[model samples]
Target chain A: MVAENKGIEPGGGIVLDGISHAYSGRKALDNVSLTVPRGESMALLGPNGAGKSTLLNILCGLIRPDAGRAIVAGVDVSKHSSEARQNIGVVFQDDSLDDRLSAWENLEFHGLVYGMDKPSRARRIDEVLALVELSEWAENPVRTFSGGMKRRLEIARALMHEPRILILDEPTVGLDAQTRAKIWSYLNQQRRERDLSVFVTTHYIEEAESCEAICVIDHGKVQVQGPPADLKARYGTSLIRCLPRSPEVRQKLLEKYPEAQRLSGDRLGIVVRDQAMIDAFLSEFGSSLKEILIDEPSLETVFLAITGREMRERDEVNSKARGKRNKRI
Target chain B: MSKLTILGRGIYAIWLREIMRSFRDRGQLIGGVSRPIIWLLILGIGLNPYFRGEIYGEVRFVIPFTYLQFLFPAVIVLNIMYTSILFAVSMIWDREFGFLREVLVSPLPKWAILFGKILGGSTVATMHGFLVLILARFADVTLGWDQVAWALVLMFLLSFGLTSFGVILAARVRSFEGFGVFSNTIILPLYFLSSSVFPLDPSLTRTQTAATYPEWLAMLVQINPITYAVDALRGALIGFNQFDPWIGPSIIGAGAVLFFFIALVDFKRQ
Candidate 1:
């Protein structure tokens, strides 16, 4: 047993060790292990039924895993969930705000739940509402707000107590592109401003690229976990595609880039290690092939290169299996 | 902050919210007071003639007032029980709206949540009873200040017990319609069998000398906790009761404790 702090502590992020959980007789999360170090942002990427929610629930102390340790901000969740809840804030995937209450009332109620005094709670509510640009709408009930506004208010409410760790379960899902971008920017700004650790689950691969660390999980297990650049480099740094006009051009392209692998009928795929190689390939083969494309190694490509299947495909198979399991039960 | 302070704040917040919402809801406030007012006026007046001059031979228990005065405390009991049970529906509403998850995830203890809700619901129900107390003059029942104070205490106790029981039921219920069905099926029968609307002693006696009620009905009323509450309220307000003065409060207090523990356990499990 590790010695635990009694009150709110700073910058002690999440740690899950060999956590295994099952629902009924089926495994929901198997040997899931990850760490979000103090004051660093980490994104958890996974498909549906990939145990993203299960892991988040464990971190937030909502559910205890069958077999393993989950320590959030230095408090063991299974042993002292109420104390662990003190150092962490959660924005659930579902709408958890009280629609009947005004924005200020919701914040006030949350503040009171967290045991904040009247003066501090009042001051903090004003500060957070202003931070979310919702100061003007503070008196309006949440049911009257737009989707983006409500999402922002939820974020604001989660930050009311200035939790050291913020765990958001798909915070930007179902939002417009602009709203998603704005939310990401706000999160990034808050992270830098407060030096807060963030453990977020997101389906959007592109947005996840901004995180300090990324863990791509599938089929209830982590496929890869590392800094974005390291994971991308471990697979291939970049991908170069050349579409030849004829078999003769294809042969010429293959001779020029000997490492190229045949891709579908007359196209060839080559993995490049550096930008210099991509520039050279594009410069020399620009006119020879019908089309040539150089693609930077993105988080999406890294996930695909390592998983051997698309994220969506894995979700479809998992859901179908789950449907069968549910039917049997 | 101290642990007690946290629990106190949580209770205060929940109680304030319930009181605020209850006052803001015009329909609920009006309905809570009007239902019993209608019963006290039309039903009490209509039933007065039947029992105006009728008398039963010496018995250990009886309502020593007019039929209208006899029915007044029962009408208040009916309103308190109804409002307390209906307040539990808000729990299902909170669950459906996802607001319960927020409360559950907080650092506050589970007992505090249940305690706060019971206190809130009871406060509102007690306020409703006070509103009905104002109608005592119209029904020709005069009460001294001491009696009014004691009656208020009984009203609070009864509301707390009924609200605790409602919270226990609400913890298991998932939907408003489901709660409505369960409470109606259970609460209405409890009220009818508790001797709230009628005297426990029948007008005519058979072989029995102490009281005139049937053996089975007396057994049920004695077993019903609300019967004690109404009887206590009647004793406090009109100086007449079916049970001893101490029996009503003691049983109701113990029952409130039991209901509160049941609700606490269920909420903690969730």
Candidate 2:
């Protein structure tokens, strides 16, 4: 089977079948399964210890799953990691560039590790540096680069060998909003131009919303998976919020809309199915309310609706697990 | 390309990068070469009068060879030992900065990566040993070209063994501070226990054997592989005898292969 595809096909993608993993007698990934289609973007949304890292380790062939198989770009990662890894490129959450090396040398080293010859390495180094808009700084030490430029250079280094799938772990975690947007724009451009499959994990709901498919994981298990629009439509389409004028008005609003929740600081939040429902709600309680705000449901609301827990709350629980795991490792 | 070519290039690439890093850090390069030179100047000249004449004459049957001649190869061994070990410490830095992740995730095998680091470090340390050998002329030692060539080969073996030992220790260390403490605790004792600064089983008189030496110190010297390295180098640079000349190269040669395999196993586990 491995010999049949000595080289990965450009259209090949990733498949994780019942992948399970444990660290120090505690389950880190519990039968977690996911897929990224050829030439598509998929977000594995998880809080810190939500088994996202373990899953990624399995996919990269760094850690073997206890009870499942991971196939990357038509090769089984466990059985043939070198071949599988050849088809995959990774950008870790940690800073991976050697600070002492120039940007060109860093990429050149990566190219050589992947067995690219001198001419190809040179050509691809130039091409990748240009792609990330870092051609001007190619000769400068990576230590001298700004955080955003370093991140861009890391992306360039990951793409030096032109792998079929790109897996990024929280690629924009510490970046400012503008830099994050720039990174996304560059990633999207590359995904389109090269027809590359991107499997990215991020805590940012909005970032996941931009992907073609989303998988929400918590407590080492995937809570939900679907398109952002479909999940939002099924869970919540619109959010209706209002601040009441009086105690009697607040009581009446709660009695009329049973699902309405009291938000922080004297305001109520309710999930409405459509604009018509929001309009009907306003018509009925318009005068009783001091203010009303109605808008389309954000991914956060969808996440909250599906998981029945806030992202921050999940993060707190996962952080404790991660702390213990970190100490053990 | 054949698999052999790919593996060769991978190892070469890793080695090339480390060399580039070592050269670019000017303080590191200068420091690696200068520490031994300082020892050769200060300690060699300082201790010359005390044990100059009769000490080595009993061991080698040679007359008028000063303590500096005896100390030169020891200092060269010292240079090779510390430089290669410190070079292996970069593995911890690589982990902390996440550059190790790139290497770990590459198509290349883990053993190949470890081999590249070992080869790079040993070669650099060996070259640094050569640089320090330039000061040998000032020590009143004759520079036979054959002796110089022999010294380099012995230096290469010694450095390879030391670097592989360093890699074994550094492979699992996660932090620079941890590695620093571990290296200090291990390397200092390894150097002191070896004959890098003092002769192991130095013959005191014509008929006396190494049994006349202190029991515990003799045992330590016998067990220390680095003692063989220094002894072998002492033979290559000057006519000397403490043990059979082949003993040093053989111990270091076997030790290099053993430590390299151990490091490879440790790295693969990681």
C-alpha lDDT score of every prediction, in listed order? 0.79, 0.80
* Stretches of model 2 off by over 4 angstroms after superposition: A2-11, A237-295, A312-329, B53-64, B172-174, B200-213
Candidate 2 local lDDT, A65-134, one digit each (tens): 8998888877899999998888888999989999899888899899999999999998999998888899
Top-TM-score candidate index: 2
Q: Model 2 residue B240 lDDT?
A: 72
Across B1-270, the per-residue lDDT of candidate 2 in tens digits comes to 888988989999999988887888798788787877788888888987765334545544222367888788888888887788887677777877788899989999988988898888888899889877998887878879988988888898788888988887787676678877887787678777776665555543333334345678778878887788888888888877578988988887898889888888888777
Please provide the root mean square deviation of candidate 2 (C-alpha atoms, Å).
6.9
Count: clashes, candidate 2: 0
Among incorrect, acceptable, medium and high, the docking class of model 2 is medium
Clashes of each: 0, 0
lDDT of candidate 1 over A115-194, digit per residue (tens): 99999999999999988899999999888999899999999999998887899988987787788878877777788888
